[model samples]
Target: MSHTLDTYRLLGRSGLRVSPLALGAATFGTEWGWGAEQDEARKLFDLYVERGGNFIDTAGTYTNGTSERLLGRFARDRRESLVLATKYTTLRRPGDPNSGGPHRKSLFASVEASLRQLNTDYLDLLYLHVWDFTTPVEEILRGMDDLVRQGKVLYVAISNAPAWQVSRMQAIADLRGWSPLVALEIEYNLIERAGERDLIPMAREMGLGVIPYSPLAGGVLTGKYSRADLTATPTGTDDGTRKRFNLGVGAVTARALEIAEVVKEVATELGRTPAQVGLAWTLRNPGVTAPIIGARTPAQLEDNLGALEVDFTARQLARLDEAGAIRLGFPHDMLASDRMRAETRGDLKIEARQ
Candidate 1:
């Protein structure tokens, strides 16, 4: 069945009802050499909320905090009605040792700053932005729990973390009676299916809702980029948005363009935009609670929202899946081998319930 913004889904094992698609505020500011300015950002926010979207995601360090500030102003009247989520742990100051990290001091400091920028007394959800290998998992969990106890945060989550560590941390939180991570955010898209190897499965097994970011593969899946765009060097006078994004972490590749071609073909067959087809593929996953949609303009946001209405036939889904499928690697492939499955199941005619 097709879904809509008002077709609220429970986030993970939690009772938090979030929209099927989340509005990402990373494009709320122009400080990144991209993104919408305040006026345009407000229009995007208004359009999403008008369509019944309530889950909005941002970070404390996004566009140097401009994203949060703009979101704060835009969401003030509807603050209580929105499921506002933001992350911490990214450095606010370049050289400060305690300004960032998943430790206690950094968590408190970042939350305080986020609260100020958001103009909210408490955050509906606070995510440990990224895993800093330095801190103990217990330290981060206990700190997040403390914030919940103090009423500064409602729920705790983790983003861009390894599956093994996150699994361990969730276990520790369960045993210690601390607030557990209710969500897992990661860069998930057709081009970047590496998270499917572990992170996606772990979130389902561990009761953390999978919130996917960059579901459009930095707009590559929108079919705007071509083979020439991949190899061309920038002249430095252009917009620099796509160039800088392509060079950033999890940059686009030749294989990604191949996947985009499939997305484009499917969109053509279905009479939908490539962005809608690409985003719809992510939504098809039962484990994915939401795919954060980032847009620099209201028109782009409208196009992305149409993804909720896009549906795929079995053949189309299979084609898209095969085109973007990643090798499970190591143990996963080994365990899924026909011989291993036969051995594990004693060659019985039993179907495994996934």
Candidate 2:
């Protein structure tokens, strides 16, 4: 079945009803050199809300706090009706070690700053933006539980952390009666399926909803980039930051462009845009609670929203999967091997559990 902005789904094990797709506020400010200005950002917010979208994702450090500030203004009247989520853990000062980390001081400080910028009394959701690796898991979970007790945060989540670490943290939270993570956010797209190896499955098993960012692979899956375009310089109309970022992460590989070609082919076959096909592919995953959509213009936002209406046939879905498939590596491949499965099951036809 197809979904829409109003097709609310429970986020993870929580009762929080969020849209199937989330409107990312990272593009709400132009201080980053590639985001929308105030006027255009307002239009994006209005359009999404008018269409019944209720979940909004932002970070305290996004666009130097301008993203959250503008979102505060735009969502003021509808603040209660929307689920406002923001992240912490990014460095706020150049030399201060305490300025950023998953530690208690950084977490509390960041939440206070976000509340001020968002012009709100409390946040609906708070994510530990990234794992600092130095703080103990107990410290992070205890801090989050304190925030929830204080009514400053409704829910706590994590992003960009190792699967093992997140799993351990969740276990600790459960044991200590602290607030558990209800969501896991990561960079997931056709070109970046590394999350599938462990993070995706871990979230599903741990009852944490998977929220994928960069669902379009930094616009590569939109079929707008080509090998020839790789050498081109950024113009006023185009932002080179994403391309450079993609390059740095090795997301702009030759194989990625090849997968984008398949996306384009499927779009042509289904009479949909590549963006819609690319996003629909992600939405088809049952593990995915939502994929954050970012846009610098209303036209792009409209185009991305159309993804909710696109559905692929069995063949098209298989083709897209084949084009972007990655090796599971290590135990995954070993467990899925025919000999191992036969030994594990032993001819008894048992209903497999997810």
Candidate 3:
């Protein structure tokens, strides 16, 4: 069951092929106060590409744009061989009203900025970074289609959008013959299984591949944190380390620590790092196409890559699932109830399609 970086998989319904784990470039610059510098970033990029990884994920505002710049420099020679994916919709100029959002103006402007920063004529994949909820779906879809027709972007995808909105957009694209969203990037990890209620299921039916971010639960599932971290206080500052940021964002909660402990036990049983076990759990999901791995150092990156080789026993999988299980909520729970199933299908046993 072990696979290497070159063990490429098709991205959703598209003909495009990418690595099982995308190299996240958000850690490519130190402008964020907690990432790798130029030389170190180059080493990370080289290490991934040398191992046959082609999917590189970034955003326009990551590290105040330094992330994309470094990726641009490091990927210059192998640009054609790599799939450079960048996102938009984050406000670049704080005071500018038209600098951000999911509207046409912001879409076009952001694509242009991403293209310039990536140092490529055309982006292999472009994602709408965040949903503003104010813009109409038609406007967003049309603008993305226009970019595709203009040869500025090869594929269009989305991240951090509601399930209903994404499915509606997919329907609109299908009806109007626009560029359909091929991938969905969301925060999914052992600690964050909320996506399981709808997002993951919707993507499976809609033909969009699920690309999970924060598979380590912001490093909580990596077992580097202890219950003591739950009591840690944050130092409010513009420039902060990831640990401080995690504390501020409530990512170091007692419940999260408990899950990490279970992950640690499972990792011990499997003779692997908790980081690898956490990542492998995400990879095991049938709906996930790839999980984005962000590492500030080459050593971290190497340890994360070991996830592809870590397999689990049924008991181990069950333990991990029980540790981080979430309720499907509302209609899902109602629809899956025994009474509903009995009413819908009595004693007849029917095989469901896979």
Candidate 4:
């Protein structure tokens, strides 16, 4: 049997609605150790599409562009029906100066190259992969707007940028009436809630869709690493990701398992898995539009997709929220206080928590 989501969700706060969950085909080549081969990648893609996932996300840096190439072939026949999104500005080449960064020239060339690789005339969504500190805000916005005018890009978005930078970029776009970032992508998971600081509020106010990548906290949420101290070297195996990603278990790895215990108990109560709880946590955040699901196999994709079946009660949510919550700092923390709420609502009646 296959798992299916209940309904589609709008991207960001935009009118464009897509599958509540999306497929991330970054593991489509031999670049990464555990990456699924083209044939297996195709199967995973098919599984996702069959389960009603219409949105797909990828980037140029993935497997030296083979990921996009494979996706291009698999998506060809159904290009018009799928919400295809890709990113640029990671690395131009081995040592090319203009090869990477969010510079206008780099962004422009990346889009054109991506268009050729994907075999699509226009991308449903295009992301400025990661922020390059040197690139000017206006240059990025104008270059992207030019693509929209040229019919090469439908929607412009961003990934791995700070809240202040996004805010400034949007203000510039507003002044120029250019195509702005409609979405923001970050590495968010039960082990990583840093985006709640400025990113979430910025997204909420700007009407931007928040699509977090690495929602599994680099596989800690899977509960496999819990059996090991993980203080040793990351295991080396064709199916192993840690060694290849060059990361050992993090300091938060223990915390991830502690949360996993609650997740397992909850899953036992609901007959689900910890992986489902991790995914649901990301999906349930208020400003979250979608969490990109990366899978190296059809079975993994199917399992992650089952996250849609996991639900949390108010009490359950409170438990996980407090467990993983990060400090928002300064004004944000001040604004969330009961004292502030009372003052902000002076003479108005409001409901209190139980």
Per-candidate Cα RMSD to the true structure, in Å, reads 1.4, 1.8, 1.4, 3.1
* Residues 1-354, model 2: lDDT tens digits: 546798898998899999999999998887766788899999999999999999999999999999999999999999999999999999988689898899999999999999999999999999999997899889889999999999999999999999999999999999899999999999999998999999999999998999999999988999877887655544444462466555545666688899999999999999999999999988888879999997878999999999999988899999999998999999999999999989898788878795
lDDT of 3 by residue, 43-78 (tens): 999998988899999999999999999999999998
Give a tens-digit lDDT track for model 1, residues 1-354: 437899998888789999999999999998888888899999999999999999999999999999999999999999999999999999999999899988889999999999999999999999998887889888889999999999999999999889999999999999999998999999998888999899989999999999999999889899887787766665465372655666454365788889999999999999999999999999877768999998989999999999998988999999999998889999999998998988898757866567
The whole-model lDDT of each prediction reads 0.91, 0.91, 0.91, 0.81
Clashing pairs in 4: 12-209, 92-99
Give one clash count per candidate, in the order shown: 0, 0, 0, 2
Which whole-number lDDT from 0 to 100 does residue 155 have in model 3? 95
Candidate 3 colliding pairs: none
Cα deviation of 148, candidate 1, in Å: 0.3
Off-target runs (Cα >4 Å) in candidate 4 are 1-6, 235-246, 249-252, 338-354
Clashes counted in candidate 3 amount to 0
TM-score on alpha carbons, each prediction: 0.97, 0.96, 0.97, 0.92
Q: Model 4: per-residue lDDT, tens digit, 95-204?
A: 99788889888888898888888888899999998887888788889999999899999998999989999988987887889987788988888878888888987887
Q: List the residue pairs that clash in candidate 1.
A: none
Candidate 3 yields a Cα-based lDDT of: 0.91
Model 2, CA-based lDDT: 0.91
Please report how far candidate 1 places residue 138 from its true position, in Å.
Answer: 0.9
Give me the runs in candidate 2 sitting further than 4 Å from their true place: 231-250
